[model samples]
Target: MAGIYIHIPFCKQACHYCDFHFSTSLKYKDELLHALVKEIKLQKSYLDNETVETIYFGGGTPSVLEADAISLLINTITELHTVSSDAEITLEANPDDLDDAKVKALRRTDVNRFSIGIQSFFDEDLLWMNRAHRSRHAEASVKRVQDAGFENITADLIYGYPLLTDTKWKQNLDKIFELSIPHISSYSMTVEPQTALAAFINKKKQQPMNDQQSAEQFTVLMDAMADHGFDHYEISNFCKPGHYSKHNSNYWQGVKYLGIGPSAHSYNSEARQWNIANNAKYIQSIESGKLPAETETLTEENRLNEYIMTSIRTMWGLDLDKLNSIAKASASPLLIAAGQYFDSGWIKQQDNVLYLTPTGKLYADNIAAGLFF
Candidate 1:
């Protein structure tokens, strides 16, 4: 019914296109961990005693920690919240960190899921992305985890960059299918401001991302996943039946969850809050028994827009009945707004549910934004 997301704010190196909060240096690592434990205890009531069905260790690179350290954090969560016995405890890791020894060590802990960051299967692309791991590490890491009896796994792949030819993209997809990894999370390359990729584009050092190329590759990705019998459960995620990431699915479904660590965000239906991004400041505030965070109370309009945005991205589509529940008759205006998309054959309705057609997915953001209150 609920989940917990813990952000481990340290990475071995920085990726060119990454904009997530992380530190290349592990200077505040030990102190940060201690403060994280304190924050967990302090925010125990955020979810109002709901059972935690997922505990995800995301960002900067959760696999950077030792097995014992990871176990300690899980143990802390168990003490504070009622975690489901079969809960999906996931660790987001880089391929280079998942050597045989590391995978074996992780198997001894509570982690039953692995979210591997295997951006590409080519050394040139890896170098271009400034990723810490190469093609060898990318393939070997997933196999090592599977070899260690970890079947609940998902690997990330990136496409739509200048160097990713159609053949190369297929090759990457083939490698994953060959590996028989049950779940995949793929994304198109985007140039976010303040990132190295953005800087490169600004200086004409690297080519900017191509929207047309991304659209073509995404179409390819969808077809390939469908051919392999993987469900396109959400826009960016695909999985064999029943292999979805419970934590992320919960997010799209609007379930309550507490976010721990710097730059983490939490939601409990009516309001949302996120901790400060500064490690030292977050640690200091937690140590002083104060939450270093900002909170937002959701208005009726805010809730409706959020629901439309998240729901439309999933296979479940947006429920007009549910939308009306948020604000009476809200779906009428939305349907009126969506008339153009309907005319374009981009959306269809059945039994009060509005589902996006395949073509509609290409402009999902635009469609969702247009229908927003």
Candidate 2:
């Protein structure tokens, strides 16, 4: 199965911690959307006729567009590609954008899931993050979506920020339980270089993120999610049974997908490609009958290393047989390197699968890097 990811590169306002490509101005919204549709048509054959199982509208905030605009894009995709009837179409939205009218409009379209960006349920945290929506708006938006019969929902929450105490973190998870949100994606805040958060910390205007606090809160999250019967499907994602994110799961499982729009990335089994990050240049190139993207063919080592990086972060762990199939010579070296982690109880090898223990998950990146081909 295959998937499609459309990046709507516009937001109402920039969040302090964000580094994703986006424009605060909506002056070029129409032109950019048209370019997106054109891009979709241009790259229709990327998936090699595999049925599209998921269509994700991720971005600066897909909710920034009207439902009709979203519907038009879905219609265009369905017309050009063979999509599954039960495809998971998800739209990432900000809380303030999902009013009654907007939700009603979205219901008329093919979208069946909503990944709301309600980073925190507290006004103080929201303000600190420079989010445009208030805490109340988040609650109201979830209620509105549920009232409108959209139950396939997930909300994002941030933890380990200087402002987020353990008590506050529990409250955030409690709020999700109270609302009966079926899926949750949570992350410990990290300071990416050049982001406003990083700048603030650099200037001593904001307290830096504490790794100890993040690790503690992550353990708290795992416990809370377990109590709520949410499956810890991935390092950062928890979902109800049968409600895992198909799009992202496909990504981890190495299913091919086509990414449309600026800064979007696409991968087939053979190669990976990414569109130019500049909105103006992306649109200009598309208008001139060109795709402003760079492509790289995956080497055997690249494929093996990528598999280790992504698979080790998921519940599925890493498949040694799959690794051997990709790079026979590299597998022994990886296994030899992984012996240190295995001896330390950070990773467990069962049959042919190498899975991380809870302790290893905190250092997932480091462990993966150590085992890289």
Candidate 3:
């Protein structure tokens, strides 16, 4: 099954660490929505008539839009494409935008899942991240969504920032557990170049991220999640059994998906494409009856490397038989490269499947790169 992702490119305010494509102004909001619907229609055949298993509304903040606006897009998609009956329709929202009224409005739509960006429940951390939501808003949003009868909820948390002390980090984990949210997507603070965080660090206005702190916090997260009975299904994502993000899981498993919106990426096994990052350009291109995107056809080597990189990060690890089907020569070189890691007790092999050990997960990227063809 395939998936569809709609990127809402507007935000009420910019987070200091965010580098995603978005505009703070809603001047072209209506026009952008029209263009998004038009793009969905234009790219309807991208998935080759596969029934859409997931429809994700990700963005600068999808909840920034009115519920009717969201419903319009979903309606447009369902009409133009073949969607599954029980499709996992998820909307990524910021805590501040999810008041009771908004939750009630969303309940009328087909969105069964809500991925709230409650980065931190501490006012200090929230302010430090320049988030628009306060701690109260985060707590209230979770309760409101649950009370609204939406059980498939996931809350995002940020750790390893300068302001997040070890005690505070644990408190954040404990708070999520207390709330009993089924899924948790946690990320370490990284200073991307050209972001406000990076600029602040360059000017000495903010401290740079510490790798040691991030590693330590990640360890704490894993232990806590284990004790709490959450499955560390993928790096940076943990969920209770059966609550893994179907959209993201499809992506990691190499299932084809179409991404609609500025700076969004799409894959269909053979090629990958990404839309232009500029909102005006995207709108203009769509208005002119053209797609504002670039495409790259995946070579065998590219596909093999991608599979190795993505699958290695998941709990299932890499499937050797599948890799062999794609590229027969890849397995030997990969196993040879993985030898050092295996000897070091960082990786284990069983029944031709490779998985990362607990310690090896800390350096997952590096190990994956080493095994690349």
Candidate 4:
């Protein structure tokens, strides 16, 4: 099955650590919406007639869109393609945007899931990250989503910020568990090169991220999730039984999806495309009846590397037999070389599936590289 991703490309304000394509100004909102609708029509056949099982409204801040605008966009897509009856329609919402009325309006639409960006439950961490919402709003957003009867929900949390001590980090996860959030995507904070946080660290105004603390916190995350009965399905994702995110799971499984709007990426089995990150350029190009995106044709080696990268990050480890079948010539030598890591306890094989052990996960990248052609 295929999926659809629509990027909103607008935020109330920029976060210090965010490098996503978005405009602080909403002056071009009307024009952008018009161009987006046109884009939906233009890319109608990109999915090759596969029924869309997930529709994800992501980036900038999808919750910032007016309810009418959201409804209009969903309606346009439904008219253009055959969406599945039980599609996992998700909207990435910010805490500040989830007022009672807005939440109610969203529930009435085709959107069946909510993914809230609540980076932390502490005010100090929120301030440090330059988030638009306070810690209180962070807690309230998920509550409102559940209160609205939306059982399919996901929330994002950040760990390992300089300001987040182990005690505070524990509290953050505890609070989420107390609230009974079904799905969580927790990431260790990193300094993206051009973000304000990176600049601050470069100037010595703010401390650089501590790799040791980050690793330690990640261990804490694993233990806590295990205690809570949350399945560690992917590297950074945890979910209750039967509540895994279908959209992201499809992505990991190499499902084809059409990405609409600026800075979005799409992939079919053989090729991938990424839209221009600039809003003005995207709109202008689409208006001129030209799609402004670069395409990459996947070579055999590229596909192999991608499979290794994604497969090892999940509970479902890499299938050696499947690999041998798909990329026959490259498999034997790689498997022979990987035996060292396997013998050293960094990698394990069971039922012909190869995966990282807990120690191996710390160096997943390096291990994957060693096994790569």
Candidate 5:
């Protein structure tokens, strides 16, 4: 199965810790929309004959688009590609934009899922992150989606911000459980380079993130999610049974997907391509009948490394057989090293499926890289 991702390149405001490609201005929005539709038609053959089972609208803030604009884009894509009858179409929305009217219009479209960015439910934490929505809007948007009869929903939450105490974090977790939300993608606060949060920390204007707190918060999240009967399907994603995100799950499972729009990346087994990150440049190039993207063919080493990194992070751990087949070498030494972690109760294996234990997840990245050929 294949997937399609459309990147919306505008946001109402910039979050302090966000590093995703986005522009704060909407001056070129109409041009960008036209470019996106044109790009979809131009790249219609990227996925070959595979049926697209998922279509995700991601990036800056997909919900910021007018309903008619979103409809036009979706319709344009449908005209160019073979969309599965039951495709999972998702839109990444900010809470502020998920108003009653917007949600109503969204329900009428092919968009079957909503991935809301409810970073935190606490007003204080919201302010610290410079998010544009309030705590009430976060809660209300979810209610509105449910009230509007959309069940396939996921909300993102952030923990371990300096302003979020254990008690407050628990409340956020409890709210999701209490609301019976089907899916959650939660993460610890991180200060990426070139982000406002990183600059604040460098200037000593804001307190730096505490690793210890992050670890504790992660543990708390694991316990709470498990207690609520959510599967730890991936490192950051948790969902009730049968509620995993089709688009993202396909991504982690190495399925080919075509990513359209500025700053988007598309992959089809052999190589990957990324569009220009600048909005204006993207529109101009697409208008000139060119896809304004760079391509990279994957080396065996690069592919193996990607497999190791992504596989180890999932519930279905790294596959030794797959590794041996790809590398054409015995992975005994790597298996032996992994066994040390297994002995320490950091990892476990059963039915040929290896996955990280709770303790190992804290060091997942380091562990996965070490097991690489």
Candidate 6:
């Protein structure tokens, strides 16, 4: 019913396109660990005693932590929460960090799923992204995890960058297929403001990201995934049947979850809160036994719009019945708003479930926004 997301706010190095809150230093790691524990204890009741079905370690790079550190956090959650016996525990890891020793060590922990950041299979592309791992590390780490007996795994790939030609993009997609990775989470490259990629584009040191290139690559990605028999469960994620990322699916389904660590966000049905992005400030506040987070109570409109945006992106589509439950008489107006999309052949309704046509998938965000309350 609920989940837990612990952000590991440290990375080995900064990637060119990354804007996530992380430091390249490990100096405050021990203190940060203690602070995370304190934050966990302090926020135990955030989920209202809901049984935790998933625990995800996402971040700057969760693999940077030793196995014992990972185990300690899991143990703490178990002590406070009635976690499901078969809960999905995922760790977002970097390829280079998943060497033989590291993978073996992680096997001792409760982490049953791996979300490896493989990004690209080409060394040139990897260098362009300033990723810490090499092409060799990218391929080998997946094998290492499989060899170590982990079945529920997913890998991330990035496309639409200037360095990734259509041919190279196909190769990257083919590589994941060849590896038999059951679940894949891919995204088009975006240059967020203030990141190195954005600065480079501003200075003309790097070409700006081309939206056309991204769109083409995304289309190609969807086709490839469908051809490979992977389910297009969500816009950015695909999986062999029944292999969806439980934690992320919970997120999209509006399940309540506690977010631990700096800059992590938490949500229950009523309100949402996020921890401060500064590690020092977060640690200071938590050490003082204060939760270093801001809270936002959800307005009916906010909740309605959020559901519309997330649910419409899935293959299951948005259910009109669920929409009306949030605010009575909401779906009738929504169907009226959707009349244009239906006329354009972009959406089709079946048994009150609004589904996006393949063409509509390209403009899903626009359609969702247009239908928002």
Mark the 10 consecutive residues where model 1 has the least summed lDDT: 323-332
Global Cα lDDT for candidate 5: 0.91
Each model's C-alpha lDDT? Answer: 0.93, 0.93, 0.94, 0.90, 0.91, 0.93
Judging by TM-score, tell me the better candidate of 3 and 5: 3
Tens digits of lDDT, candidate 5, 1-373 = 8999999989999999999999999999989998999999899999997899999999999999988888898898788878899999999999999998999888788888999999989898999999999999999999999999999999999987789899999999999987779999999898899999999999999999999999999999999999989999899999999999989988888899999999999999889999999998899999999999999999887777788888889997888788766657566777887877887888888776678999999889898887877
lDDT of 2 by residue, 177-203 (tens): 999999999998988987999999999
The local lDDT score (0 to 100) that residue 55 gets in candidate 1 is 97
Q: Could you give me the TM-score of model 3 versus the true structure?
A: 0.99
Reference-based TM-score, model 2: 0.98
For model 3, give the RMSD to the true fold: 0.8
TM-score of each prediction: 0.99, 0.98, 0.99, 0.97, 0.97, 0.99
Give one digit per residue, the lDDT tens place, for model 3 in 32-101: 9999999999998999999999999999899999999999999999998889999999999998899889
Worst 10 residues of 2 by lDDT: 323-332
Tens digit per residue, CA lDDT, model 6, 94-126: 999999999999999999999999999999998
Candidate 4 lDDT score at position 206: 99
Off by over 4 Å in 1: none
Supply the global lDDT for candidate 6: 0.93
Q: How many backbone clashes does candidate 4 have?
A: 0
Off by over 4 Å in 6: none
Which window of ten consecutive residues has the lowest lDDT sum in model 4?
Answer: 322-331
